[model samples]
Target: MSDHEVVDEKPEVESTPKTTETATEAPEDTTAATPKPEGNDGGEESGDDMPPLEDIKYDDETDDAVKKKRIVIPEDKPKPKPAEDGWLDVLDNGELRKFVLTPGAVGQPRPERGCIVAIKLVVKLEETQAVVESESHELTDMIVGDSDLFQGLDLIIPLMDQKEVARVVVSSRFAYGKTGIPGAIPPDASLDCELHLLSVQWLDEEFVLPIVDRIRIGNRKKERGNFWFGRQEYSTCIQCYKSAIKLLDATDEELESLDTNELKEHFDQQMKGEKKSPEDEERVKELVDIRGVTYNNLAMAQMKIDDFSGALTSVEAVLVTQPNNVKALFRKGRILAEKGELEDAIKVLKTGLTLEPDNKAIAQELNKYSAKRKKELVTERDLYKRMLQTDKSSPPTTPSKGLWGRSSVTGLGVECNC
Candidate 1:
């Protein structure tokens, strides 16, 4: 039989009327209508080629349970390492760090507020160690607490002394921060700096030293000025003396109220009492003497530079403190003479001579000006005499023009030819 033929062992039963009754009675049974073998024509079961389907059923409990379930995932993160040792937490705020490469002078005066400091600086990237800006040879002057330097530097420089070199690490918050300088530093980049403190000039404390030390320092400067003066370095000498004078706490007006000897006597009297110490008295005397000498040297330098007016001022300062100061008096007289104030010069020289009658220089200056004055007086007298004789020899008269075409002298009544 062909594979398409249906074989039935109950073929005799299907031809019977009972089989027809059974199909009519179960007319709604479609499963019985189509009959086929469980296997295909190839004799392999078709059911084996496909998997069975499992029934899917749902309830409220099942849906609630499904909604309550959560998915958990592991996150990946980097671990932080500990900070390196031997780094100083500068600024105490942890925004800056420092490591000293080399130390500078010990016990030197640190910079104070409003003082100007000179520094050499280098800036680099903290990560790549790449140089960003460097100022090595040319030192930049910054005023403490008042300059436009980086805030980190302004905070750090006050702790350092002259000639100090340090390596500082500034955090991004303290450095240029997120908005860094274009073309110079990167954004949000930490900076590495190499700093050198060169010099400091404390303007606030320039005149606040102890009187003894002030006079001692002034004397030292004056000695240096004398050395320079001997070498004919007039400009340098003037600068040194000026620096010495700037150390004095007294003003020109204050020094003018009392002469040097009177100041010494008053200081001695004050010392005898408990008001001032012996050391203080000595310092005051020295200061007064040194100030007079400084003024004299300054005047001499000014004269050398052809600054006669400046020389006059300096000498007058000296004369104010020491009215009998011979050098100051002589220089003042000379300056006056140079300025064509001969009368004032004569009076100044005469006063100096009264103080030192035996001074040959003063006497000679007085005699010279006196002789010049006498000569001037005689010339004036001769001029007046000539005018008087001419007026006396002629009477008031008017002359008309003669036949010649020449103007005649009227008062003299003299006629001239053409």
Candidate 2:
């Protein structure tokens, strides 16, 4: 159908509903939602755009997942411990410090006493097994449980028996602290030392101190041994010789003060070397002769001091080396005399005189005894002659045989009186 025709026909019928006059107010005032700033997005802002800082609250579900980060420090960290049967890490810094329990308990527990120990040790750096120092000594003693030691050593000694063995790496604080073993180690350094407890006993007041000082001095010498050897080889400068002689002389002086007669003699002989100048062959020979002379003189001193055995040994050595030595032969004779072997003494003296016929000292010694014997013989002979003369001067008087009871005899001719 033609739309216009049907619509006009229907509209002409005036299809309109009854209108009740209902009043409608104007649409309430409407407001539009404002757009947030660039920073605020659903309530989230860029870190830069946010205030300097703000605390953000979190939910329970996320709290457990977000952990509190913690920092672990090595120094404060708990040290790993070991079992009693096994090796224990007593200390741990850059290196590991360990202590081992001995088989038997320490005998005569002496916390207050101290004793010398002979130790065989092998030292190595951390994590690597290369020995930096290895040695054995019949010395080095520590007072047990005393803090005057490396911390590691202090711990180790208390746990050891008299003959126990303890292995350890001494920490920096225990070993050398910040300043390490001067030329051997740097500052804040650690060292590994194996200590074997060879023995223990009560401390000897006189023995401990000198021995400790000796050990420390020996350690210093060990540190300088190679250097000295090299210097001795290539540095024969007069200054070096002077320094050596100074040391030798000082040793001699110390021995002399100690009354160490043998040691003093050794030092003296070593110090009194060949003269500085040898102008001729004779001078050189004289210089060479000094050693023998000093040796003999020392032997004589020993003999004077009643070190008979020592004197005998020294003189014997000299005789083996120099059979024709007058000094040695004379010294032997003197020693034999002191020992009360006058026969042996006379023989040795005679042999020496044969070798040194014109030695006035030897001749004088022999002549002194000879002259005394001759004077005694002369006195005895003169006494006998005097007895004979007395007999001749006064003739014997005999009584007349039968008749005369008594008779008097005169000298020269018998004159009787009855």
Candidate 3:
């Protein structure tokens, strides 16, 4: 009956446990706190949008299975093709390749045989830029590529026309191989060549017959060494002379110091029974003559090798037999010139020229010596003049000032008044 009047009866209902309000302090302003990069936990932060760490799943359960990968990428563009179908290819292949004989190519359907070529070439080692050999020759005979010729040479001869030039690469198989030239090429070395073709001549059957005969005869007479039958038999003489030279080549200074007279005596002993009949005697004389000639030739070889003293010895041996031999006299004079014995050189050269008046070489040498003598005389005269001029020069001297400013008269000298 009094629901509206209950408000006064409830002791204010304990004010419903009034609790005090606590402010959250705006959550400690967490944005101002140490901010972390995105996707970061309190642990290690993999800042990548997708972290590298992932669960690797493999179908193979084996413990030692290796991981495999397959990747694809772009490649470079293709290169241009080389000029591989010309005479260069023929040379490389050691034969002519596919080529059509056309008027446009060779100006004739068929190139003529018996053709000659004038050529120039520079030969160099493949591994270096240094030139090994060079030649410029006006050759009158060159045949093109065929099975009959050296394959490398065959390939190139046909490619060139008159005045055409080319660079050729020669392999070791086509050039000098192992055991190269004594002082020139190395073993198994390839060569680079630049060739200039100056001219060509077509060879006909008649023009080629002589070479064919030579080749056939050379082939047929392989076993027969160089023996001129029915001619003056100089074989014995040639053999002895060659043997002597060979011995000389094998000797050193120790052997050379042996008495030459004793060597000659030994030679005579060896040659005692050589002349058994009149013919034998004649051969022996020829042999001796050839031996003398051989000695002279050896001397010339020695001169070429720059062994001047050895050359003099050889020339002396020759001169013992033929004193008036102009060649020996001229060679001796040249040796003297090399030794710087100018007076002796002039004397010998003059003697040789008198013997051989047509010897232009000796005349030239004499002229050189005369000019040199004149130059030396002029040099000496100039030096003498310089010495006399030096002697005529006067040196400066100080004048005495009346003996320390006091003029005194002495009995030893007379004084002049001032």
Instruction: Please give the lDDT score at residue 113 for candidate 1.
Output: 71
RMSD values, in order shown: 39.2, 45.8, 36.7
The all-Cα superposition gives candidate 3 an RMSD in Å to the true structure of: 36.7
Whole-structure CA lDDT of model 3: 0.48
Candidate topping lDDT: 1
Please write out the lDDT profile of model 3 over residues 272-343, one tens digit for every residue. 533223343333333334434556554555555577898788778767656777767877888888887878
TM-score of 1: 0.46
Q: Please provide TM-scores, in order, for all candidate models, with all chains considered together.
A: 0.46, 0.28, 0.32
Q: How many clashing pairs per prediction, in order?
A: 0, 0, 8
Task: State the lDDT at 33 in candidate 1.
Answer: 27
Model 3: residues >4 Å from true position, as ranges? Answer: 1-243, 246-285, 392-418
Candidate 2: residue 317 lDDT (0-100)? 58
Q: Given candidate 3, what's the lDDT at residue 297?
A: 50
Deviation (Å) of 14 in candidate 3: 99
lDDT of each: 0.66, 0.48, 0.48
